[model samples]
Target: MDTSPKIVASVVYGCCPTGEPTVPVHLPGRHGGPNRGELQTVNTYPAVPATAGFFTIPAHADYRASAATVAHTRSLSFLKPLMGGPCFDLEAIWDEHTRYEFADRSVEETMATMVDEPYVNHVPTLTGGIGRAKLTSFCRDHFIFSNPDDTALELVSRTVGIDRVVDWLYDHARQTK
Candidate 1:
């Protein structure tokens, strides 16, 4: 018989600084074990209101010497020279675009962040179009205006290069008919 503690899924929680609350996290156990693919609710933190699902780390009013701050300062010092020339932060731009998308903003407002002509292709459905006019029409008709109210996006990772950024994300939405 195996006496060792079975390695379970790792769960990461983003917490608020104010209080340590119990948060329930669902974990799907591994297959073919004694706990055979069972859904388990692990109460981790103190209970927080359902509406307060997300938390932000509070910033200090005054600068303090911490390991993280020190590392950040050093990183900035190193990056300052490399980023000195006129450069655009693609991450910020992508974040703004994501916000606009989830908020279901106007197609014109969303397109403002893109080039004069842009193309989008939803490979699975083959639903997107090319050029500003067609893309704008597609967004207005099928995506921006028609997205569900509870639509959300989970950004897994982003790789920003000299001229392009590739983002891996999960789109969460409810189908409405």
Candidate 2:
């Protein structure tokens, strides 16, 4: 009598429910064969039908869908825990920094968001500083106090990403000679 364990076919689904759909992957293990112990290589397959309460998996002619699904899963693995959690509002942080700059407030608060030893570089004028002391001094002497009382800044756009926010801004101020 045959007592070997019967291997069942397993299906790997994609993470995205709507964007990128994946076919139901069928692994080889039904009958007792050479690939009974090992998983069969999946080259191509038809996508699983989209039913109520189920995701619509897309069919791929080649291995593109499999590769994309893997990439998406890998990218979302770390973000799963952070999703719907207390996320940092970059816009509000930028507003606070701007308020500190325009109101001539304490540079300490502005520098709080930065690392232990932070550096700033004004690429255009090649003027900035390194470390807390130098950066604070530069902000006080060159940026905050030096600007006119009517100075204003216009925010063009802001691009927020995983760990950084890129702001496009235009400063409007009267030059005093």
Question: Cα lDDT of all candidates, in order?
Answer: 0.54, 0.54
lDDT against true structure, model 2: 0.54
**Pairs that collide, model 1:** 21-45, 21-46, 22-45, 22-46, 22-47, 23-45
Stretches of candidate 2 exceeding 4 Å from the true structure: 1-86, 174-177
The Cα error of candidate 2 at residue 66, in Å, is 27
Q: Which residue runs does candidate 1 get wrong by more than 4 Å?
A: 1-86, 173-177
Among these predictions, the greatest TM-score belongs to 2
Task: State the lDDT at 50 in candidate 1.
Answer: 29
RMSD of each: 20.5, 14.4
Alpha carbon deviation, residue 158, candidate 1 (Å): 1.6
How far residue 26's Cα lies from its native spot in candidate 1, in Å, is: 51
> Candidate 1 on 153-176: residue-level lDDT in tens?
777998875456788988888566
Q: What does the lDDT read for residue 23 in candidate 2?
A: 26
